[model samples]
Target: MAISSEPRLGASTNGDLVNRVQQLRLDGQLGAGKNSRGGGGALLPWVLCGLLAVTWAGVGVRSYKNAGQKADDTASAPQGTAPAASSTNTPQPAGPSAVAEGELVTQLKGNVIPSLQITVSPRDVAAEITEIFFAEGKRVKRGDKIATLLDHLYVNRLNTEVASVAAAEAQVTRAQASQTSVAAKVAKAKSALAAAEARGTRATAMQERAGKDFDQARQQRASGSIALLDYQRFDADKQAADADKIAATADIEAAKREVEAAEAEVKTAVASTKAATADLGAAKARCAEAQRLVENCVVTAPIDGTILTKSADKGALVSPNSFNVAAGICLIADLSKLEVEIDVPERQITRLKSGQSCKLQADADPTREYRGVVDRVMPIADDTKNVVKVRIRAYLKKGEQQGEFLKPKMSITATVYNTPFTFDPSKDLPWGDEATRK
Candidate 1:
């Protein structure tokens, strides 16, 4: 409707231009509307995209730094060596360590033994076992009695011998008195013989005087001057004196013989007395012997020791020299003193000596140990085993307490050290030097 001034659509030059402008305006309107809708939707999307881009950038930078650190560590490490093998290659040793060694040592202490043994038995008296008075292992003095035997018969014999001695003594006294009586008879006989001799001499003188008177009377008769009767009387008197003289002489001789006989009787009585005295002495000796035998029947203790074995019992018969039906009484031993016999190797024995120190360990008690000194060493070797037999007297150390478990005949081991040995540092040692050895 406004066609008056406007160029018409079909006008030559301006028509095309005006239609093109209208077409451009319509296209611009559509483009503006579409742009407005898109702008509103794209606001939230663009904000989300910006936050994502910043997060991705931060992740990439962290990854790059981690890779760089790994590369640096790889370059710094040692090459061609495993970590486990490197530590294991160093050398280490194992075992118990050694302490100080190579000290000067003397003979190893050990046990020894007695070379000979002696058994004692009773003599002179019969032995009987009664009560055991001593314990085993105790000490005793000599001459102590150990047992006794019955002696009733010996006692009776002693009494009989004593009576015999008394009887013999009485016989000696009676014989002495008889000897004195015989001596007195001999003295009286000698005095009577002397008086008879004097009488014989007087009778012989009277007989000679009467004979002379008779001859003178005969002469007077011849001369017829004297009486015949007087002469006859004188002759008779001479005859009688002759006869008396002869008798007196014979009586003197007989008295002399009697004196000799009495002297002989006295000598016989003295001999009898001497014989009686000798018999008394013999009887007394017999009595003493019997008494000694009786006393020997009572036996006592021989030593203060315990009995190890009983060989006889009560009422068993025993002999002085032999055991007879019974075994030889009891055996006893002293236990206060102890000894051990050991056979050491010949090589080991050369290094041992008396009075050396020793350490002993009994197999039965491994934890317990004992200390002893060597009291003796044997010079000879054992013939059977070809080993050196040694005897050791072991005395417990003073003030040491022994356990009850210790006993005789227990097996034991001992350690002996060499004497006069030195530690040489220059030489390689089986055991190391002082600091390294045990």
Candidate 2:
């Protein structure tokens, strides 16, 4: 029989086999004679075919092993995480019973935020930060000191005002003393005037008695019953009484003038006292204002919360004009009150409603899922992005710390169900599934 050279297995396989056989014949491995029809020479094609089969078998085995290794690698490697991952080893929890078939479920990206965040800044006063009592992430209560500003200027102002108040009070006291002295003088003058009037009355009475005696003497002298010397003596007595009465009248006028002057002095003193009191009042007002400014220099927390960030450090200059982060001392927030802020497209805004249930997964910790509800859907929309902002009130599941995983400003993925779910802020059951409590 003649050996056919037809390529059966493949072009390359047949060519390789043929080339190997030719080379073997040239090398005298099969037989030395070309026309030699020995058993070895006749078995060459069968041996080559057997060798080819064996090579193909090894190749097939290697390929199978490689394919199996790839499959195993694919099966063992980690896969991409879903939007909301399961908190436990089990799969993600199912949506609430409120969700119906083919309901519009909207997926959104948002950031975690505190419901009440306060930016602490100095008001009205411009001063350099001297000390910081609290650091970032520190918890504090209302009225707790957070920072202190340099108060030397304010202290100096307060001291000046205090001194002014003291001076004003002293002035008021002096005026009061002067007023008392003048009032006493007025009383003394009044007493003197009364005494003068009494003296005048006595003088008039004596003058009248003297006149009666003189007249009686004149009548006696005319009737030849009195002597000339006695009459002259009576007239002298009347003249002396008249002079005494005139002097008494002059004394009374002097007393009246003195009383009037004293009263005027008293009025002047009262006016001075009133002015001094006004000055004291104004000084006190200034002092109180200065004290308030001094107290303001020490910044304190307005509410019970944790410090989010420290915008200004010690020795930094700050003022009310430098608002926001530029002059702010720190950011304080109530970590217990948390929310998620998302922007939904205008077309999808209709699908979102208040009180709708939502599932949240923070990018930082994708393994845990949080529960929340749509608290508000902003009525306004952004013209540039054509999206409306939405806020979802959220809370940590049971056994989780307030700010451990869901922190302010943390990026997260949120899934909102169109159906509304009953939510109670006091309970922790709705935050996690009953089967897999997180």
Candidate 3:
């Protein structure tokens, strides 16, 4: 049967038709074909993907902002705070600070010293050192026996000199006695010559008388008044008288010769006396020298101080000419008076002057300070070290007492304070304007 072209509103043949129509209408709302399922399923996945993308973008933005902030902090940080890879890096300098010109005072202390040095010289052979009476650090006084030399030989020589002097004096006395005796003999010889001359004159007068008698006898013979025998007897008598006169004259000449010989003896005696006197004087001088040498055998202290060094020992040969390597047997120093010697740079020496106040401090006793005055500043600087040796006299101040414990050759540091008259033309000085000129 042919279906009617007209619409049939309520003619439901099967229930499938109604259902198909309802499904078709549902498909239309959803979409058609593959798009319908794909679009619907993709909606949930797309939403989840959108949420993940948004979360990732937010994390990246946060990371970028944090990195930029860190870079800004790094750029603004201080340079000093940065670490260096090597140890050779230098540190930055500090801020500027003010500086001033001021004096620096120091304190020093030292041992004492002697003002004079004494040495003994021996004239004879080298002496053997008998004993050394002093040791280092031992205090000694003037005239104290510090050392001794062998005295046996010197004593013997002195004795010999004494004996020689005595012998010479004895000889002088003997010569003087001899001279007196010779003088007496000379006087006696002179007297004898005078008596002999007087006798000779008497004999000549008797001879003349005898000759006259002989002549008278010859005349008598001529006149025949006397016999020939008598006249010959008279002539013989006259000849005998003349011979007696000649003998008397010869005796007088012999007496004169004896007197002259005696006078010569006296002269010789006087010469001997003079020679003996000279020998006596020489002997006495030698005796005195021997005495002086004996006294020198006992050595004495030359100064008042403490012995600081000693090299002499018993049995050692000591000679003044010997090398003084260790400085004569012992060294004496005056511990009461201490001084410091320092070689100041030449540049600084010009600023120092004598009588300027100074301070000293010894390395041994740092706590104790000593005050002193500048004793001397060398006018010339030493060429070897280009320094001027300055000597300072340090007087112990009241209340600070270091007695005999101070020793010589101790190392010390010293500071010399500027004197009031020190000249400085740069600025106003501590002293008055007049001091500046000096």
Candidate 4:
């Protein structure tokens, strides 16, 4: 299969050789020669040689024709035209300056996503869905009602808690009233004790005066100056005063005991009031919890966003326990702020960085190009895919609004650039520095 560079006969020479080989076959010269050689095999070699020569001649003619045509084409080509690539030679890569302007540094495939997504579900309790206010694709604001759950149970519990709180409050009031009554009783007992002490003092003074009087009277009787009746009267008055003193002492002791009893009752009442207040506080806490649960029955949007999906329907039972397994009432997302999540090959991850500019094109709408910036490079890598997760924040062009075209979970391709791309007014295309283009 070697190609000889030596001058070869053209098509005419090839035609003549073909004619000669045909004439020899027709004239029986091939057979005559075979007989003289005593075998047909000897003649076979000559025939084969002739056929090979004719093939080479035809190939040479074709090569010549191709060469002439190439020459003519070269002559007609405009000046400065690049030469055709040589199959034998490897192509040299473009130099940094030779690269086209605005060429992407790297391209990655990913999915469009919302900047924030939330799942709306019951907080802790399970309930049957009673109503849904928002539909898929509907725009909602923060605190807007999204759905309602069966709240009879919560309402009942709240009522019970309220009653318990009221009861606790009544108990506290009664204990406080009892405390006041006991305190008053204590005061009364103290007053009685004070009165009994005053009477005892009076009785002591009377007893002293009476004893003195009896002694004076006895002296008079001894002197025979006073009558015996007078002496006896004085003695009788002394005994009465002594008996009054003893009675006053007993009354004072009894009043002191009553004061002690009353003070003890006051302490007991104070303890009861404190216990009742604690119960009231506990009841109030329960009441507050019940109120919260009741409010939670009316599910609300957590942020201003669009409803992406509705997983729960009316009458469907939902619970926090099965939340991991079951979907929520609806999926909400902020469509105004979108992002692209890409798993860049580990080899290309080094070139990616936060704040780098990017261009995004959704598979569903490749004609439109969305602007984006590298938002983050996840610290962790995917072990199975040997890739690093990268996030890009997508933005609409000036005068463009976030529409339904770009949606969450849409497949998208992102072209990352080393620098921000600037629009070239004249070219109507993006442009960048030579380094960036390279």
Best by lDDT: 2
Rank all candidate structures by their TM-score, best first, as comma-separated numbers.
4, 2, 3, 1
Q: How much is the lDDT of residue 219 in candidate 1?
A: 89
Prediction 1 global C-alpha lDDT:
0.60
Report the C-alpha displacement of residue 125, candidate 2, in angstroms: 3.1
- Model 4 RMSD in Å is 14.3
Question: Whose TM-score is higher: candidate 3's or candidate 4's?
Answer: 4
lDDT by residue for model 4 (96-154), tens: 22213444456768998887899888887688989889888898899999888899999
Better of 1 and 4 by lDDT: 4
Candidate 1 least-lDDT 10 residues:
96-105
> Pairing residues by index, what is the TM-score of model 2?
0.64
**Candidate 4 worst ten-residue window by lDDT:** 425-434
Q: Judging by lDDT, tell me the better candidate of 3 and 4.
A: 4
Pairs of colliding residues, candidate 4? none
Cα lDDT computed for each candidate against the true fold: 0.60, 0.82, 0.69, 0.81
Q: For model 1, how does the per-residue alpha-carbon lDDT over 1-438 read when each residue is reduced to its tens digit?
A: 444866656678545644654454433545667666665533544565567669989999999999897775454222332222224668643431221233222222233222222233334556454443344443344456655666767788999999999999999999999999999999999988988988888878877877787778778878988877876787788889889899999989999999999999998999999999999999999998888877767554454444445555556666646634553556654433445566665544555555554455667766766554344667788778666866554444334332233445566555433232233334212222235422
Of 1 and 4, the candidate ranking higher by TM-score: 4
- Ordered by lDDT, highest first, the candidates read 2, 4, 3, 1
Model 2 lDDT per residue over 1-438, tens place: 987878556568667767777776532653456546554565666788798899999999999999897675454222331233336766643432233533546777899889899999877688999998998888999999888999999999999999999999999999999999999999999999999999999999999999999999999999989989999999999999999999999999999999999999999999999999999999999999999999999899999999999888988898877544366888999887788999886655766777778888999878888778788988799999878999988867766666776788899888877666555546553433424421
Worst 10 residues of 3 by lDDT: 96-105
